[model samples]
Target chain A: MNRKKENGLSSEKVFNFCNCAFLLVLVVIVAYPLYYVLIASISDPYEVYAGKTFILPSKVTFEGYARVFREESIARGYLNSIYYTVLGTLVSVALIITTAYSVSKKTLPFKKTIMVFYVITMYFGGGLIPTYLVVSRTGLLNSVWSLILPGGVAVYNVIVARTYFENSIPEELYEAAAIDGSSNLGTFFKIALPLAKPILAVMVIFTMVAYWNDWFTALIYMGEKSKYPLQLALRQILIQSQATATMMGNMDGGYAEANKITELIKFASIVVGAVPMLIAYPFVQRYFEKGFMAGAVKG
Target chain B: MKKGKQGNTNAAVPKESLWKQVVKHWEFYVLLLPGILVTIIYKYIPIYGIQIAFRDYNAVDGFFGSAWVGLKWFQRFFGNYNSVRMIRNTILLSLYSILWTFPIPIILALLINQIRQKRFQRVSQTILYAPHFISVMILCGMLRIFLSPYGGLINILGEALGFIREPVNLIDSASAFRTIYIASSIWQDAGWGTIIYISTLSSVDASLHEAAKVDGANAIQRIMHIDIPELIPVIVIQLIMSFGNLMNVGFEKAYLLQTSLNKETSEIIATYVYEQGMLKAMYSFSTAVSLFNTVVNIILLVAVNKICSKLSDVSFV
Candidate 1:
């Protein structure tokens, strides 16, 4: 019996060690590439190409950052992205919270029917062309509203928000507020909304990140260069780099200067595109975990 | 006669009560108006416009004014040369991604749960989940750079390790596109997917593990007996839910990843729809194709949901 116990203890210890080792490997695999991108963004473009900047910058330079900032389109794209993200998040979160709050209440008449209406869209939808036809027919083309309004409310997020409202907010609070002569809307505004900070943070971050990252809407709806979001602008830079590189191939070393600049800007643009989210990550990380769990588990 | 009068009165009371309920919740309903309006306009209006899939769909003709073509466009799409290839590509991509990407998260969640140190677990999680937040265009750009034939890290490392005699142009190759796409997808999504499972794991009774340990079960045995069983429901639900959109892969990523060389493997249904509908303006034909895809996806979802419900209690519906 003692021998068996000793064997079990040794086996568990080995398993524990192996588990840690495997996870550490996973962490390195996931993290090293991101680390490389950061280092590559600051390294010399030639050295980046020469594969000398893997572990650290071969030579430090701010050329990439400088060049990216100097691009007129990048600045325009930045402002456009900010405007879209801010406005879209507000619209999306407001609509989501209101709808979710209404449906989460068990006393709300036809709650199940209202929920069915929302849920059906999750399984089936109007396909791409038809949706585009609707967008164009409404004359939303080449406008900011096209980006914000077409997909303003995500059904899945609404469901998650509803779950958060149902599970997290105590029903007694609403009852107490009701007894205090608060109307349903007042209860929502005064009591429920105050308690829903975690979900609200999640929704805002999710919506903002989605809007900031979205280029497909801009690609389809906004034909003008001025209306292009940062992602699309970055796409343009990417395409431009590829075009210049291919065009430079025939010219040998003649286009090398331009090629180098585009190369460096490629890395710099990634860092630029990701900077806001990365800065916000530490602050919002806990809420992200909570929000995701709330959405996933309850949803 | 008395019973009939009571039944009528009972019906009358429910109607009155419902009206009163509506009156009481009028503010909530008012708040819901924007959401309702948006849903109707953006989701339902276009759903109504799906009839264009059966019409000629000319801009001058408008949606209803266009001549009804019945199943003509569907026939044309089915008879198209690349129809089979497109179907194959779409299904294979979805299947491959599910197979490769699904298990890693389950394993990651398990491993993360096993970590004794809270700080290390949290740090690992943050780092792991970081890539999911990177925008598609930037992620694709990183892919291109990292897979470049000349001086890419992969190529350099491959050469150094004698895995390759010469650097290979990994991005442009058609055969390599799926691997690159799937790998990047897992890299981006796997960590994020683990959160659900990790959350599920937290609900697992610690006492059950203690019982297993007392029964002389080792760590692996406890995981097999307790953790895996606990996770099965979540995993099955996830799998069933995902099947609802089986035909609908990540449109943005696939579109961004497409190149002239990799177009053969990369020309999926979503991108093809965009090409035909937006780029070439074959509205009816493209709509028909997209409609077919959606229908098939719905059927798959229902079938999977039914099957999962039958096999186990876990299901989406």
Candidate 2:
């Protein structure tokens, strides 16, 4: 019986080990290419192309960063993207927060009708061309507002915010504030907005990422690269990478030329581009990750 | 007679008094004004440009001055050579993707749940979530390199093992396109998807699992009985959401992934819209197509939302 018990215990242990091993392999498969790219960016380009660059950098270099910054458009693009994201996120959050707050109130007249109207647009868009014509016709063709104003309230975020407010904010607080002779605006500004920190964090993170990552508007509206976002700039880099790749093909003694251009450096572009958000990630990770947690689990 | 007098007074409340009620609730209107103004400027006014679909949409003439052309654009679009292929490819690709991409994370989540090692689980999750941050453009570029016909990592392994006679052009082949896409998608997303399932699984009753163990049900049986059933509502909601997005094949990834070879299989509505509506200058025709697409999506959305509600009694609505 003791010998039999030992055999059963060892089988369960093996089962446990097998499960862990399978997941660990999955994790590596997903992560290594990305981590490898980061290591490759600093490695010698020769090693990168030869498939010898893995795990660590053979020669550490910041040439990729230096080259990217040397491009005249990179700085302008960074600033443009920053301006767009910051200004756009602020306006979006303000509009969404206030509207969501007012609509969340049970006593607000025409609330249902307004929500229905907004949700209707969420399901249907006028497509690209009509929207473009409308933007240009309004004389916003070359303007920043062309990018910013077209998509004001991301309806999904609004719905999430509304749900958060409904679930989290006690209806009694609104009543108490009203009984204290607080005006609608006062009550909302003081009580509701204060109580909305978690969802607001989520909203800010989402809006920031959306505005930052958005190049569709930049591509469609901004004819000028100076007005382009970082994504547009990154796209320019990729285009240049393609052009250079072709140009190198035309040159015969391409080994040295290839060495000059590193796949690691190319990979590093992603890191450089995403570095800002990664820096900001931890700050909002507390709320941003958990922000959706409230709604997701509750639903 | 007393009831008749009360009814007369109730009927005496005039339309003018209803107007008075509107005035009494003037603050509500005021509260709604700013939001309405923004929506009008940003949302509804642009919607009015849907009239372009009914016109030639001359850039020189603009919307109001453009000559009305009836359903000429729509007729032309549906009558075109590429129309059938484009529509069929879009639906097929999305259908295939939905079948593959939607359920993967749930499976990963279930697998991750049975693992009792806290450190291993945490590390695996972090590794998996990393790919979510990689942009689609970069992901496509990575896919290109990894699937390159010559000296690509995948081919090198295949050759060393004598698995094939020649290096395969994975991305270029229509047959291989879906597999490459699905694999990359799973690699990028499976771990991220597990988060939801793991959360759901943790809430499973410990006592229930203990009872199942006592009943001599093995691991697979326990999972079948307890875990999968618990995930049905989530799966239903996810399905409805996925179906609602049936028409919207994202432009960036598909556009990047397209080559001369796989273009036959890969072209979807979003990329087609990008090319025709924005890239080329077929504004009116493309706008009509887009509007038609939008209508279909909205109808599908409502239908699925209703279906989910009826079947599972769980819905976004």
Candidate 3:
């Protein structure tokens, strides 16, 4: 019996060791690329290309970052992205919260119909062409409102919020409020909204990340370069390489030198574009997991 | 006499009329108004315009005035050589992605749940989920840099390890496109996907594990008997949800990753629609193609949901 127990303990130790080792490998696989990007961004482009900056950066310079800031279009795109993310998050959270609160009520008239109306869109959309036509015809083309309004209400978020309200908030609270002669709106504003802080944070962060990362809407609606968001601007620099030539036109460098600097600039811009989201990630991660728990519990 | 009878009933119980109930809940309706309006305008209006797919759409004639051409655009789309390729590519990519990525988070979650040290587990999770926050554009940008023929990271490493004598242009390789796409997708989402499973696992009774241990079940045996059974419902639900979105592959990443050389493998339905509809302005044809895609998705979703319900007694709809 003692020998059997010893064998079990040894097997358990082996299992734990293997599990930790596998997870350690996974962490490295997940993290190494971002680390490489950071080190590459700071290292000399020549050394980067020569594979000298793999483990550590060499000939570190701030020239790439300086040039990224100096680029007029990237600067404009950054401002535009910030504006859109803030405004868009506010609009989305407001719409989702209000709609979710009303729908969560058992007494709301035509609740099922209202829910079905929203849910049908999730299964079927009118394809891209029709949506584009509607946007263009509505005089929203080339306007910031086009980006903000067209896809503002995410039905999934509304459903999640609605589920939270249904499960987390007690019917007794509403009953008590009603006993005190609180109207539906008053109860919603006073009781529901105040109690919804956790879900509200989740919605805000989700919407903010979505808007900040969005490039497709702007690509479709806005034609002007000045109005481009950071993602779109990055697309031009990194993917299409259209802006790199123009960006290099002002700098006093030959063909080889300019090519090298352009590579560095691409790396630097990636770091810049990602830094904001990464900075917010820890806080966002905590709330997001909580939100997911809330969602998964009853979903 | 009828009025007197109604008044007597009303006095017995203060029953409000439907109209009265609606009026009493006017504030609720008011709260619902913006959402309703946004839905009608954004979602319903586009659905209304879907009729143009049936018509010979011309911007000058407007949606109503366009000539009806039943199945002509559908015929045109099917008649094109690229249609089969696009559909095949879309299905294959999605299937491959689901095959590879679906099982990973479950395994990760199971392993994570076994970690004795809470701090190590949390830190590992944080690092894993970090990639999810990176934008698709930046991801593609990094891919280009890492896969470039001239002194790319992969090439440099390949040479150092003596795996390849010459640098290969992986980003432009038709064969490598799907692999790269799926790999990047797994990297981005596998960690984030663990949240649901981990949350589910957290709710599992610790007493069950202790009981299994007392029964001389080893760690793996305990995990198999106690943990996996607990995770089955969540896993099945997640699987069903994924199957629901089986046809809706990530268009953004595909479009961003496509080069002229790799377009052979990368031209999926969503990107095809965007190109034909917006870029080429073959609006009617493209809309028909997209409508076909959506119909296939709905059918797939329903069919999978039915199968899952029958097999597992756990389904999502």
Candidate 4:
């Protein structure tokens, strides 16, 4: 009976089987690296060293997590990341939505000129030194404003939000609001803002991610180590792992303990850094898709 | 001059009445103030600073007071010792990325389009695209650990398989940097990049696939004859966009991954610019080097945008 079914399988069935198998393999390939890190973070550093933690995590331990939480810099980095991401995302979204809504209006003056002005920046930009010089000249260096203000308004986000407003919001609502003696500001605040929740969510997610992941800005602008964001702090820890090891030369178990802790910390820090984004992802994911579909492609 | 100047029925008829237009939509104009202020401060001021590339820019002398050196900085960049090496490394790495990274998304999208199970498809997508959100620091750290000579998963596996006598320090090797860089980028982005293509493929008419099926065309045959032809324009547009920004090798990842051993291969123009401009304070010369990179990028962008428009009516512009 099994032989008969196998023989009777259509090409489509075979294709589906292969397709599923391929995707499963892809899932493993894509996910395993991250999964490996998570498992190694929790596993005995020895099991990880022995490579026995591959198929399943062996000798589970919370020592890495404990160490990470106990680290003062990591805690400070978390606070800094949160502050920047929240403040930056809020400012960026407000600017983007207001600018985009304004540009999306058919009656808005010089709309085409404004669009051209924005789009030109996408193709051309001042190189690093010039931009850095400008930032320094403005006395923005070593300030939180340096991170939030320099990239305060992304033109691409503006364009995307504009497209969303132009395509999604109905003209009748605006006209009706106008007829009802609603001023432009009133219509925008009452009508446009409420209708723009999806794009708003998209902007929030994007801006938050950008601010959270940004180290280069803080790396360049910050003169003090205390101002470093989580990503930059993580970079210092990872890149300067040798320094940590060498410093702990006379500690208990000597260089070996230091090396093992460094490895554990590396794995743990990745988990710490990534967990917030991953946690926030699913909640905003639907809005993300909706926004992308609405703005990114007409198809 | 304004481009969106249109004759209105409300009595402000002339196209040149900027004051009238501004007064008429005063609220909207007011709303635009914050965004415009930011653009001026952050974007245009930087453009004004680009002139420093041509001058001996002294912080004390300021913009206008800076000594006019004309083409000296550009000349110095071209005549520098590592100029050829940096340019060559940048081009080679970009080409390698384009070769290895570009096609995976298209192929993945094709494979994804074949899946019949909706739940599985969604799960796969979530799992796959998750990597895109991983920060570069975390990614580099992960790569460092995974590829370590001692007790790294890759090395351990290799040893277990008897592929080598002992583990190798892959991350620190010059020969391995480009491959690791390209591969990691592909791993991060390929899944996310499929979103646009998959969206395109979904909009491919169902009737065409049905017709092919009715004609006894197999899965491969249908994909080849129908799906790929429909995908060509999008692929071309994407390729053009990638090539246009070819010179902009990202600084963060390369800088994070760079070791003393791998510096020979990993030192691209962006990283070099950062070192010279920020670290060494060779502001003028580094500005010139980066200005060259930007100009090349813009030229490529314009050229490709033109070609794409002419060929496929799908230009990024």
Is candidate 1 or 4 superior in DockQ? Answer: 4
Q: Please tell me what DockQ candidate 4 reaches.
A: 0.66
* Pairs clashing within candidate 1: none
Model 1: DockQ score = 0.62
Top DockQ hit:
3
Q: Choose 1 or 3, whichever is better by lDDT.
A: 3
Tens-place lDDT per residue, model 3, B179-230, is 9999999999999989888988998998989988989998889888888888
Highest TM-score scorer: 3
Provide the lDDT at B109 for model 4.
Answer: 90
lDDT of 4 by residue, A39-143 (tens): 999998888898798878898888778777777678889999999888888888889988999998886777778778777777777778777888888999988
Clashing pairs in 3: none
Model 2: CA > 4 A from native: A1-12, A59-61, A239-265, A278-283, A297-299, B1-32, B148-174, B213-218, B306-310, B313-317
Give Cα-based local distance difference scores for all models.
0.84, 0.73, 0.89, 0.84
Ranking 1 against 3 by DockQ, winner? 3
Instruction: Give DockQ for candidates 1 onward, in order.
Output: 0.62, 0.44, 0.69, 0.66
Candidate 1, residue A163: the lDDT equals 90
Worst 10 residues of 2 chain A by lDDT: A239-248
Model 2: residue A254 alpha-carbon error in angstroms: 5.1
Q: Native-vs-model 4 lDDT?
A: 0.84
Give the clashing pairs for model 2: A40-A264, A41-A264
lDDT of 1 by residue, A1-299 (tens): 99999999898888888888888898899888888888888999888887788788989998778777877778899999999999888988999999999988776777878889988887777878788888888899998889988884678888899898888888788878877899888898888899998899999998889999999989999999998999888887764354333322333355576667667778888888888887787788888778877887443
Off by over 4 Å in 1: A1-7, A239-253, A296-299, B1-15, B313-317
Worst 10 residues of 2 chain B by lDDT: B1-10
Cα miss at A224, model 4 (Å)?
1.3
